[model samples]
Target chain A: MIHFNDVTKIYNSNVKAIENMNFTVEEGELVIMLGPSGCGKTTLLRMVNQLESITKGDIMLNGKSVWHSNKIEMRRNIGYVIQSNGLFPNMNIEDNAMIVPNLLGWDRKKMRDRFNMLMELVGLNPDEYRKRYPHELSGGQQQRVGVARALAADPPVMLMDEPFGALDPIIRTHLQEEFLQIQKELKKTILFVSHDIDEAVKMADKIALLKGGKMMQYAEPARMLNKPANSFVAEFVGQDRVLKSMSLYTVRDLANALTLKPVIESPDSQNINENLSLRVAISKILNQEADQLIVENDNGTRKGSITLDLIEQFLHREIKESV
Target chain B: MCSGGDLIVNLIEYFVSNFTFILGYTWDHIKLVGLAIIIAIVIGVPLGIYCSVNKYAASTILQIASIMMTIPSLALFGIMIPVLSLINEGIGTLPAIIALVLYSQLPIIRNTYTAINNVDPDIRDAANGIGLTTFQRLIKVELPNAMPLIMAGIRTATVLNIGVGAIATLIGAGGLGGIIYQGILRTNNTMILAGAIAVAVLALIADLFLRLIENLFTPKGVKK
Candidate 1:
């Protein structure tokens, strides 16, 4: 677990970038540090990795203060991904992924194996991409390689700074989905910083919203949406908190045994994946005449189904709990 | 037809008779230009990198280089002559060598500094973000990225050095300049033409050689 105790960052004679910040990120949880452009969320994220030095207070990793370890070794063990996708132009994708490992003096065979595995993990084909340089790859592909490169060493903690901010909307959503799948499998402790609240809600296990460098609210997406800490948060989350909450949840979250079962009677022409957003399920249910929709998991196994009545009841229950 | 034919005959005869005489000076010219350029590079590249790294130092070093560049080549040689004379290095290759070295600093240093400083900040951020030490980043990333521009500088320096080396023969530093000066003193057009053509070819050869290196070393990803 990563713990920040009264962390504050001061610049040039006392401009407080972050003030008296306190937060704990549990191991294997993806925490999105969300705020406006100058909210110092990025500063807070960088401090965990010691990229930005803490002006005051201690940041402990696994209950040990980071100062006790060598800075280079500490950074090597913590993966970092940036929006610019810092692949070395001189090296091909394979070499780029192997940089940290190469520095740590991993054997040739081991680095090669990890490169192939990471390429597949981030949804890039190693055969086609390994020899291509960073400049040769498209923006989306380069970012995918960036993610793979960051995870090449299999670090327990990963820091991502607006990893998808440079991509187009379609590519961004696709990458986000792919990343969530990776996160689910890897379960690395990730501190992701983004100004986009929708991204935070979609991907974060917990969203830490900040205003003027102070924590406005730090809670699960559902709680943050339903019970905003203050007016600033309520407005930042917007009038469509309920609708936004729907995006945070998916078909699998609500389609329990009450509505989910093996496909029965007839197979509808359309099927929704169990992993698809609830918004899509709602659209599917409303668009078609069927009362229910088929749901499949990652393996394409016909796990369960979602019905119109179940979604309505789930929404009603959520509204009741929030009130 | 008569005038043109006579000119052709005169050139061919001049070349055949003076082939050995020209060959020795050509070798001397190559040595003069080659030595000066190599020494300049040895001093220049590191100085340039240092200037790029330090802000205050860059302005001072660049001002010195710009000042050197603005001086007339002949006058610069005159200044070097007296300075070298104090050590009994007066008149000949040493003073000329010193002059050539001074003349070369502007292109080599300026190119190296600009190339190194021009490396994208994003690359440096990423390198640091991924845990590369500052030294490793310089050696592995910055230098390779700056190679093309640095090579361009060296090539310019080599060509300029060769042209300047030709004038050094006036100070008794023997080269093709020996031929050019003799032709000037005796009004021998044929000798002057020969020296001029050889110097041009030498410059072209030097430029072509560095271009090959620049192309070979430049990262494919960075190429347009």
Candidate 2:
């Protein structure tokens, strides 16, 4: 657990980088600090790893203050990643992934195994790209290696400062999805900073909205999007706020609410996973010319059917509830 | 002006007779320039890294190096003689070496400073973001990225030093310059040709040696 208690940062005596900020990131939770430029989101994320020293108050890691701890040891326990994907150019992909592990003096064989596994996890082939340098890979590939490097030492906490901000839209979404899958197993407590509201909505378990270094509101993705704290947050979340909200709730939520038909009719190749969004299910039903689509559980067992009418009612119900 | 056939025969005769004489002078020239360049690097590179971090010092140091560069090689040698006299190590290879070291400083210092500072800020951010210590960043990341340009600077300094070294004989230091000086005083054409040729050959060898070192040490990722 990470906690910030009345933190403030004053630069050159007068300029304030952060002001009286306080928050907590619980264990195994991915909390996104979201705002525009100069919002001190990066500063807040950095304070967890002690990259930015707290000018006032205290930042507690596992209930202990960071200021008194050995800075290097504190940082080593927290994996750090940045937008540029700071893989060392001199080291090959393999060595880059293992740099932190090596620094921590993990046994050589264990590090080697972790390197290969991380490479595969990040969609890179260990055998083909292990010996290659950062420049040898494309921007997306380099970012993958950067992510792999951050995850190498298996730290319990990760501090990411716009880690995917540099990638193109498609690659960013792909990485975000892959990262979600990775997080399921890793279950690391992550503090991510992002200027993009879409990225925060997609990746955050809890969103802390900030403006002028102040926490405007902290809520789950759906609540933050649908019921914003104020005008500033509403405007910041932008248009299609309802769509963003609808996307956050799963088809399973909608399907479970509806009466289930145990029978499967007109077997179709396109089957929807129960965990998918209502938006995707609606589109799939229309594209396949089916009034209702099959919904499968985690084990690929047909759990129920989701019809387009139910999707429409769900949207209407949300609109009514918001009003 | 001899015919082509006569020129070749003369070249062969010159080589056959003066091989040992030429070889000894060439070795002296290499040692003189090599030591000077190495000492320059030992001093200049640290100065460069220091300057890159401290802006006030960077401008001051670069200004001093530029001023040093403006001094004529012979004039610098003349200044060094008295300075060395204070230490009682005057008037020969020592003075010549002192002159070359001063001459080499501009390239080595300027290049090291520029190379280190020229490393991408984003890369440096990543290095620090990932928690490598300051020294670790310099040795592992900053140095590797700066090396291609730094090596280029070293190559420039080495070649320029070797060429300037042909004048080392002016201070009574034995080198190809001695043969050239003797030939000039005695009006011996064979000695002049041998001296000029041997210096030219030594320069090519030195240039080749440095270039190979540069290629070997430079990180392949940063190479063009």
Candidate 3:
């Protein structure tokens, strides 16, 4: 768990990067600090690792004050990834992954074991990638190494600052999916920073929307999308709240809403699963080859039917609410 | 043909007779160049790092060094003769060493400062974020990354020092250049060629050795 109590950061001559911020993240939860450029989101993420010192209040990790702990030890216990994928150019991928373990003075065997395991975890093959220099890898691959390097020491807390921001859109989406899978298995407390609202909605369990050094809203992604706390958040979230909200509503949400009285089967039924969006369901309905859309329960039972009119009504209502 | 044969024999005999002296003189020249390089690096590198860390100090020190570099070597030595005579009247190896040290300082200082300062700010920030102390970062990351440029500077200093050190014989400092000066007074072209060739070879060998060392230590990513 991490807790921030009235934390503030003032730059060289009183330019406030962040002002009197307070928040907490539970263990195994992914909290994203979402905001515009220069909105103090990155500053807040950096403070978790003490990369940016706080001028005013206390930041505690796992019930201890971060400032009071030995900084090197604290850093070793927290995984940090930056936008540029900060792998040391002087080191091969294997050596980069081994850095923290080497710093902790682990034995040779332990280091190699940890290195191999992390390489696999981040989707890099140990034999093919371990000896390659960072420049030889693509941007997405380098970012994976950056993430793997951070995870090598198996820290309980991970802080990522726009780790996928530099990748192409396709690679970014792939990496985001891989990262979500990793986070689910690792169950590490994660604080991510990104300026993209869609990325925040897709990746964050809780989103902290910040603007002008102040946090405008901190809530679940669905709530933030359905109802922004202020005009700044709404505007920053852009004109696509309903579409962004689709990321939060899994096919499961739609399935849960189904009445279950009638069963409808179609040839394209597999296209709609527990993870399809409402927009996808609306498309499936408009195709009109089938009378009703089948909704399945978590256990794969045919829960109920979602009519074309019902999905259309939901989309219309969402669009009206967003306006 | 007989005259040429006789000249070759005479040359070989002369070389055999002075074999030990020639060997000892060459060894001493090597020692002088080596010592001067070590001293220059010891004094210049840290000074460069300090200057890079502090803005005003770097500007002042570089300005002074640049002014010193503009002074002709012979005149600088001539001016130093009186000043250095106050400490020791006999003009010898010490004055020569001091002059070469000055000549070598600029490249080492400038390259070290530039290399450390030019390292990617993101890399440095990553080092800090990873919790390396200032000293650790300097020793492990900054120094290693900056080394190729620093070594290039040192290489320039080494070759320059040897070339300059050869001129020391004019002031009674003994080295292989003593042979050249003696040859000049006697108008002996053979001896002059021998000295010049030896100095050239010494500079080339030193350069090749440093290049090998640089290659051995340079990180693969920065190797272009």
Candidate 4:
């Protein structure tokens, strides 16, 4: 677990990059720091790695103060990937990937095993790419090498500063999906920074919306979209809250909103779950051939009926309130 | 007093008769220039890398070397003569080698410093983030990236050394330059041209050879 306690960073000249920030991330969670450029998202991420010193307060990793630790040792244990895919120009793909392991003095065979595994994980075949230099690879491939290099030592935590920000949209989307898949398998705690809200929404298990170096909201993607904490978050999340909200709901949530009849004999016996938002329930009723949805308890027993009229009244009230 | 045809015939006759001597003289000129450059590289490259890594020390050393470079070669040799005479009476190849080495240090030092310093900061940060020790980063990344630039400096130093090495013949250094100096004293233009041409050819050949080596060793992605 990583914990930030009243952390603040003031530059030597008195500019505050971040101030009075406190947050904690559970083990194996993907927490994104989302903000516009220069909003201190990058600075906050750097603080975890001790790349930027804290002006006040402390950051602890697994109950040890990061400030008191040896910086090189701390850095070795934390994987950091940046926007430019900072693979050394002189090193070939395999050597770049094996950097940290080599530093820790892993023997030749162990290093080779780790390098090959990481290359395979990042979708680079060792035989084809091992000897190729940085410039020989494409931008996306270089980023993969950057990510592979970071994971070489298998650090429990990763700090990514817009690692995919430079790639084209198509490649970026593919990489994002791949990243999520990798996260699921590896379960490494990650603090990702990105100015793109949609990416934040897609990739983060939890998103922290930042503005002016202050966190406006920090919540799960569903809650952030359904109820933004402030105007800044709402605007940053943009005008398509409904569309963005869809990403928050899986097919399971949509399935739960469907109206089902308890008995085929009675037309009004069909009902929607009252717990579901009226707009979603009404859409389910209209879309499905069923007349109503039957609400159920946690044990799968029927709780009550949600009539079409009730759903209509609920939708009307919600629309009026939103307007 | 010789006609143009007579001069041409004389040149061909001279070349045919003295082929062995000319070849031997050319070999001696190459040896002198090549050895001086090797010595300069052996001393200068590491100094350049060291200076680049240690800014304060590098600046002080560079300042001293720059000052040394300002002294004229002839004046430097003249100054060295009295000091060197105490060690060994006659001025010879030693003074010339020492002067050329001093002259060649600047380009190698300056270029190496700039090359290592100019590597992208992001790349350095990446290496650091990945847990590369300072020494590992220097050996594996910084030096390799800095190669082409360092090589360029080395090439400049080498050619410059060869040119200066010829002038060393003025101080009892036996090479093609001795031929030139002797020809001048004797008013023989043929000998002067022979020595001048030999020195120029040596410089060209060394430059080409080093260039080939540079291309062979430099990482493909690195800009030359």
Give per-residue CA lDDT, model 2, range B1-224, as digits (tens).
Answer: 67868877887898899889888888898889889998999999999999999999999999999999999888887888888889887798899988889889889999999999999887887777667898988998899999988888888898888878988789866778888889899987777877888888887888888889988998877776
TM-score of chain B of each: 0.95, 0.94, 0.88, 0.91
Ordered list by DockQ, greatest first: 3, 1, 2, 4
Recovered fraction of real interface contacts per model: 0.71, 0.62, 0.67, 0.73
Per-residue lDDT of model 3, residues A1-323, tens digit only = 99989998989967999989999999999999988788998888888888878898999999999889998889889998999988888888888888888888999999988888888988989989988988899999999999998898889999999999999999999999999999989999999998888888888989999988998999887778778888888888888786678666666665555434366555644334556676666656677655666776557776666776666566565545544
Stretches of candidate 1 above 4 Å error? A257-276, A285-310, A319-323, B1-5
Residue lDDT tens for model 1, A1-323? 78889998999967999999999999999999988889998888888777788888988887878778667788888889998887888888898888999999999999988998998988889989978888888999999999988898899999999999999999999999999999999999999999888998899999999988899999999889888989999999889887788886788887662457556757563576777888777877788756668778888877666677778788878767765
Off by over 4 Å in 3: A260-271, A283-307, A312-323, B1-25, B86-89, B188-194
DockQ score of candidate 1?
Answer: 0.66
Q: DockQ scores for all the models shown?
A: 0.66, 0.63, 0.66, 0.56
Query: Which is the leading candidate under lDDT?
Result: 1
Candidate 1 chain B: minimum summed lDDT over ten consecutive residues — where? B1-10
Segments of candidate 4 deviating more than 4 angstroms = A258-323, B1-9, B54-60, B86-90, B220-224
Compare candidates 2 and 3 on DockQ and give the better one.
Answer: 3
Q: Where is the poorest 10-residue window by lDDT in model 2 chain B?
A: B122-131
Candidate models: Cα lDDT each: 0.86, 0.85, 0.83, 0.80
| Docking quality class, candidate 2 | medium
Clashing pairs in 1: none
Best by DockQ: 3
